[model samples]
Target: MEQLHNKNTHGVVRFITCGSVDDGKSTLIGRLLYDTKAVLTDQIQALTKTKHARVTASDAAIDLALLTDGLEAEREQGITIDVAYRYFSTVKRKFIVADAPGHEQYTRNMVTGASQADVAILLVDATRLDTSKSNISLLAQTKRHAAIVKMLGLKHIAVAVNKIDLLNFDEEVFKKIKEEILNLANTLKLPTPQVFPVSALLGDNIVNPSKNFNWYQGPTLLAWLEGLDISSEKSGVNLRFPVQYVARQDGSAAEDFRGYLGRVESGEIHQGQQVTILPAGSVATVAEIYISNGLNSFGQNTSVEMAKAGDVIALTFSEDVDVSRGDMIIAQDNSSDLLTKQLIADICWLDHDALSTSRKYILRHTTNTVFTKVKNIIQILDIETLSQAVEADSLGVNMIGRVELALQKPIAADLFDESLATGSFVLIDEATNHTVAAGMIREAL
Candidate 1:
């Protein structure tokens, strides 16, 4: 057995397991954690003693699903209701795994988990599918989840035909399922997904290959994950820094010390880099960069020469420009034009109440929030057929649709396909202060 290590040579890979309810999503995650020795002995003992533990003929097997089904309701009902996240690392790579709920009502929860994931491991229950039919119909929940992930721009997808052991590890059944999955992907315009036949319960073809199936010849699920190239698409892009806070040393010895504090959403910022402040359209050079040490009582910050994406730092400009909290800073030379008051976006309706076009919503994108109205409900997407319906005027809860939005003012944003950080926004109900929808900008109209 390979020893588990905390250090990783490759960067972290965030993935989510999603499928219909009772499809063994939780079991697959638990098996990965168990095989990698991520779970402690005490946790294993607790699993065996739990009332929900699965009983075998010889002994009470450790209920691996219990490792991620942490909520009381989840344990009592034996279903994942909310998204549960777990972290584990190997010598090759680090992983952050999310176990998403599979129910139709909780589709919003699954979207939340998939938004941050680099890859999605879609679990399919082999026993529940009928292979005798010429046209195999997948569960509605499965199609919905798959569509949502594709809409979210997840480039990598893997289908795990789970519970293969129930069919006596039959190779023909696995092939049928794999064929259906490919058809589904082609219909959704998604890239070809890597398919695997595995038994999450018995831990076959997950971390290690099983001798039960000699015909199947593919890397184990863990091996494929470890070898994936997780290099960010954001690399080589121009800088995009959204100003969140403005810090000033009023009583310090040095006068005119103004720092714009926020995270570098993309690209890099150097000390002498020339950047343009958006909306205001003012150009200034970066004078100094200070890496924020978080909240300190002494108010001391370490000055740095440069900062890259994912870094939260304070930047000082050469000129005293009128920079505000909601302003964005980008490279002046190569940045794309982004100022626009109208936008076309794809949205996932998340509220209990249906979307109303006349109602006004607070559109929060990055550090900026603006009042906006839904100008038009362009079309509603049919998840089953992957088609668009233009007749719908209103969108119900957990629906995905395209709409045109009219903002109060122009804001700097990129297309969702170009930059997820700047192109995504959430619609908030003004009266209830509840997030009603999550939107991705498709075009600046």
Candidate 2:
């Protein structure tokens, strides 16, 4: 029974807004911030002074897009180019919101934001979906972003049919768009997705229910977000603790003060538990555990009975075992066959320099960086058709592909579907040390 302090803290939910250009990703986020009363007085004053502000006879409205589109170029062009993150909290939950770029050229920026998000809010302009002919589908970016979200393994999705106010809150128009989105979700085999009709610019059906939409009995966007169960999503993972540092004291107490300091990436660790150290294949018993209290600070070294996922803990071992930074501390019962050299992964190319099989790059996972090379370009994914091209020679910027990699050493890792924290990595350019690509492990080869 670990004396774990207040678990009553409201959990943080990381979510992203993505769609085609002019789909209102930035405005949606700005609405969330303002309606929640998270905006400061000065921020409001700055928005009011901007030329882009929209005012009504009865009330005034800021160019809410300016809230997330902070770049001068973005504001001038009225388009988002980079991923913008905003943090706010309600009584029920805290939120870390990301406004992803909606342009086709900035697909890489959207991928970067969606990779860490727990849920995705896919926005669709209601005006686009009001098709007189029944055959045409939604925009290309709408479908492309949905496929990428599924590949990233973000199971929870919220289809927000935005700008419904443009349609005079027409129920028939909302139903048509909802049906089209649901059809797409079924084709992608996406999990149960929730749909909401919203007007981010007008703040309708966002934080508060809209009187204009009397037919909609669904929860508001904020309410649905608050009701999500994030803990269930984190359960059933294996223990993976990557040692960031070895904590040592310099006094008589130092004799017994050999502790491995790191955050628990997944699963639970308990006192008296037998653990295995990777690469070395050594075994040791967990002697005691101490959880961090604050920055550069620690609580009293108490003998915690158990520590679960997301805890930043320092633990001492009963027996001496060789360990250092980059070493993994996994429970003995959870050990699996580790991959030593070759692996197959899904990669999203992020650099101007195309991936070349002839060049050696740096592969970084967790705390380890190793020399690696692209062995084979198996296939390139076509976002439009959601199919693969078997004859790809190289992966271009913003292209998604499957590739085989040869590493200098092995890494203790899991399939991306099984464990997100340990299964993802980045490729770095050896010369410039720039992040060239992001990868999610499919399996060991």
lDDT (Cα atoms) of all candidates against the true structure: 0.86, 0.84
TM-score of each: 0.94, 0.89
lDDT of 1 at 378: 94
User: Candidate 2 on 358-388: residue-level lDDT in tens?
Assistant: 9999998887688999999999878777678
Q: Which stretches of candidate 1 lie over 4 Å from their true place?
A: 1-9, 54-60, 234-236, 252-256, 294-301
What tens-digit string does per-residue lDDT give for candidate 1 at 346-367?
Answer: 9999998999988899999989
Which candidate's TM-score is highest? 1
Highest-scoring model, lDDT:
1
Supply candidate 2's per-residue lDDT for 280: 84
